[model samples]
Target chain A: MARVIRTIGWTLIVLGVVVLLYVVYLLWFTGFETQREQRDLADEWSLTVPDDPIDHDREVDREAPEEDDEPVDVGDAYAALWFERDGEPIVSDDVIYVVEGVDLPTLRRGPGHYPESDRPGGEGNFAIAGHRTTYGAPFWSLDVLEPGDTIHVIDRQGREWVYAYVEQRIVQPTELWVVGEDPLGSGAPMITLTTCHPRYSDAQRLIAWGELLDDPIESTAEGGERDEIPES
Target chain B: MADNDAPNGDDPGPRADPDGGGRGGIPRWVKAILLLVVIAVAVVVLFTTVFPWVEERTQDPTMGTMLTPWLAYLRF
Candidate 1:
């Protein structure tokens, strides 16, 4: 009986240690690793790109649906986000910094852009997702985001597009429409960010939607190019 | 019946085993083989069952598509 009790006790101890390590990895270690990845991406983006404008005007090609096109590959990053903090108290850093594409590997790096969502500087809803309570918990303070907080997405050409947080709502994990809605009919440019809700629980989704502060203007196709990135 | 066979009616030794076959328990080599077989089956199941499921989920960048909800139950 004592042997059996000892075995069960040891198993529990091992399990407890494993859980603690996992939390540590999710909270601290993963954040540190992602910081390294972001720095590498920043370095890569600063180099190996040239100045050539790429046209993105959808008006000229009305017959073809531009919105349905796939987002950039998981490997290629387009923008790094910088949140304005002094103007807002909720921001943990000046940069809540996220790389392009919200795939698992990409998200492990930082907040990921939902490729199906509208691109930055577009007429429809542009969406991004981040981990709410783990793996750096980029959006852990999402509950703190309210009206007036600014989320910035920098274009490949060094032009920064700004969006202002309007409101945030908590919805169940089953609430899929928030990310699927088409705002093109409204003729307003919007940005939506979704993360796990209630912190440490996946029972809900915390969605913070924002409208573009910058007026959508004609692009010279520069946002698509691999070059022309400013180091600063 | 085996309890009556103990030398001094004190230490039951191998006879105390429930099976009463004089085989106290599974042999050490048999236990090792069982462990190896269990590990091999687990690896096979993971590759054949879990690996593909994960691949399909990651193809889309959306949050719903990326999450393996069942795996989130432990939150560990």
Candidate 2:
């Protein structure tokens, strides 16, 4: 009887050990490691902006030649503003805004903003949200982006607007100021990218803010020249 | 006493039955119950622990190559 009891105890101990090992393997070597690796790679490519130039304005608005006004190609416009990582396309169907005087669209779970808010390409903050972990993790590397990395927002009219990153902040889920109606003051054009924080949970949101660096630049024109319109 | 002594005099003392009074062994129902318990435990371990861990690893962009299907699922 004693021998049988000993055998049962030994079996339970072995089972426990096996379970523990499996848990450790999954935690350390599986999805967690993958997330870390992707972020690390992204960090290598992110360019940091210098603090000394914070007050300096490098905005530009070059007027395009009136004669070259043939309808701009939307495909070219998309290509001009698109960003790629590891040869995988990161841009989605959603459009980001970079033009002044445009109102930000309403925040929603899916594609396109609320109808009452600004329409895509119309301008304000053409904000978009994506999952940081699931859904192919499109914005998983967004945190790796640093100040000065270019964000391009192209319109269907073949007008491409360029933005330079200014700052990034991790905000609580309840903080709506990151997407405030008066982001950067009234009529200040900006582009905001948001994603789930910590790259694992949706408990918080991470935001990256940028200001328009130049006026709408048409892709059809030679050498990517900016189009000038009267300032609002 | 005379009838009991003569027929089994050559036989040894009363022997114990190897089959325990002809009673059957553990029932099939008991075996089935044990199997179900094992399966339940395995499922609990998988969903509560294993699944989350796998998800975390796949979320990592660096290890994304190891989970091609997981990455593909991210597209809308």
User: Which numbered prediction scores highest in lDDT against the true structure?
Assistant: 1
Instruction: For residues B2-70, write the lDDT of model 1, one tens digit per residue.
Output: 232667557765445454333656544664566567556755665566643543332222456334668
Q: Name the runs in model 2 displaced over 4 angstroms.
A: A1-117, A155-159, A213-232, B1-30, B37-76
User: Weakest 10 consecutive residues, lDDT, candidate 2 chain B?
Assistant: B58-67
Model 1 regions lying over 4 Å from their true place: A1-20, A48-71, A85-90, A181-186, A215-232, B1-76
- For model 2, the local distance difference test gives 0.43
- Model 2 chain A: lowest-lDDT 10 consecutive positions: A102-111
RMSD of 1: 10.8
| lDDT (CA) per prediction | 0.58, 0.43
Clash number for every model?
5, 14
Q: What is the lDDT of residue A186 in candidate 1?
A: 41
Query: The CA-based lDDT of model 1 is what?
Result: 0.58
lDDT of 2 by residue, A5-84 (tens): 75467557756776777656643444444344334322321322122211112233224343433332221111113332
What's the TM-score of every candidate structure?
Answer: 0.63, 0.41
lDDT of 1 by residue, A46-125 (tens): 66323321222112221234454345557565665655533433445635445667766677777887777777656678
